[model samples]
Target: MSSKSDTIQVGMTNTFACSYLPEQQEQLLVLQENTLNVELFEQLLTLGFRRSGETLYKPHCPNCRACQPIRIPVKHFSASRRQKRTLKHNRDLSWSIVNTTSDEHYQLYQQYIEQRHHDGPMYPPSRAQYDNFIQCAWHQPQLIEVRDNKELIGVAITDVLPNSLSAIYSFFSPTQEKRSMGSLMILIQCRIAKLMGKDFLYLGYQIDASRKMNYKKAYQPYEILTANGWQQSE
Candidate 1:
């Protein structure tokens, strides 16, 4: 593992319109390195860094500090009544972990972006875009496919670390919104982490003001990384 003394070069990107919040601009502190191994990447994750393809970055907006990194303490997590009901409702769906992405997975991703996130940046999804956004050269992400009866319904892109799993991204069949596949995917990651004896399941950023990004709080008791370090949330 890379120690605190190991130097990872970082560069800030110019401000851009915030995707999650309107009327707000966003900037990112990007890791500038030619090669990043799993050990170094894992160390960066602990410091609030996240991966997008091969690039690692974190929010560095000068005017806002709303993007808080959150993680689930696998041993301490207790699903709420609503989350329990969500799991029960989707009991028929089966999931499996795969190391590579498939054409079917891309098809599902395209549909998800078109139907659910049409207004967002990833709206016009294509095969090249899908590959570039999810696949990384150094890290092999696990694609957790959730199916119903034999049909593909959801895909959760996750990065397996030495001691934890980072949920890179997830998408489901918009037609099956009733299943609450988003929450189901997160719950599945938590279970996988615990079964693997991992310490935590990183859930990326939790922006409380952004409805689309704030649902992560439901997975309590989670820890939100703050200026004072990770604090347990009820």
Candidate 2:
């Protein structure tokens, strides 16, 4: 597989925005065993990246902190009445928290990619691509699958950080859109973090204006990591 790895000294001079920049200086990358780890994550608790529903990250660029992490504070979390309905909505579904990628799992992935993200890069993720997507963490293949008997409905990929559980990716059966399996998966992660006594469940960036990313904003009492500091969305 192709790889990109680097480690830089702890100075702003070595920093740069990766994906979100015309100018590169706001983000820093740390090397752990010559691989890129979350230097920004260390700043997450302070830089405004809130955990909820995958990874730790802040907006990197000339300026934009909308890329905040959305995390659930388990001890203080209360399932909203709507959230409760979402869980009960999928009660018929069963789950198995195992590793990702299997014959059954792959087929489900194929359908989800084909139906849900056809216009996106992973529209037709090769087996290799799918494998890589879930294999980057210490928890390689660590994931959960929501199924209906023999039918695979959705997948949630995650990693456990020092003080948090980070959700990597989640995709549900397009045919079962009414099920809201995506949100249900996050809800499950919140419960898991609570049981494990972890402080937060890290949901990746919550970009408001992007049609593909708008739903991320709903995972509340979310905190957005900004250049100034962590700010509550509402």
So what's the TM-score on candidate 1?
0.96
Worst 10 residues of 2 by lDDT: 28-37
Off by over 4 Å in 2: 1-59, 62-65, 137-141
Count of clashing residue pairs in every prediction = 0, 14
Model 1 accuracy (lDDT, Cα): 0.92
| Local accuracy of candidate 1 as per-residue lDDT tens digits, 39-116 | 888888889999998899999997899999999999889999999999999888899999999999999999999999
Positional deviation of 27 in candidate 1, in angstroms? Answer: 0.4
lDDT against the true structure, each candidate: 0.92, 0.64
- Tell me model 2's lDDT, rounded to 2 decimals: 0.64
User: Which candidate achieves the best TM-score against the true structure?
Assistant: 1
Q: Which regions in candidate 1 have their CA more than 4 angstroms from the true location?
A: 1-6
Q: Positional deviation of 31 in candidate 2, in angstroms?
A: 6.1
Predicted candidate 2 versus true structure: per-residue lDDT over 166-226, tens digit per residue: 7777877798888888889988888877887888776766656456666755666665555
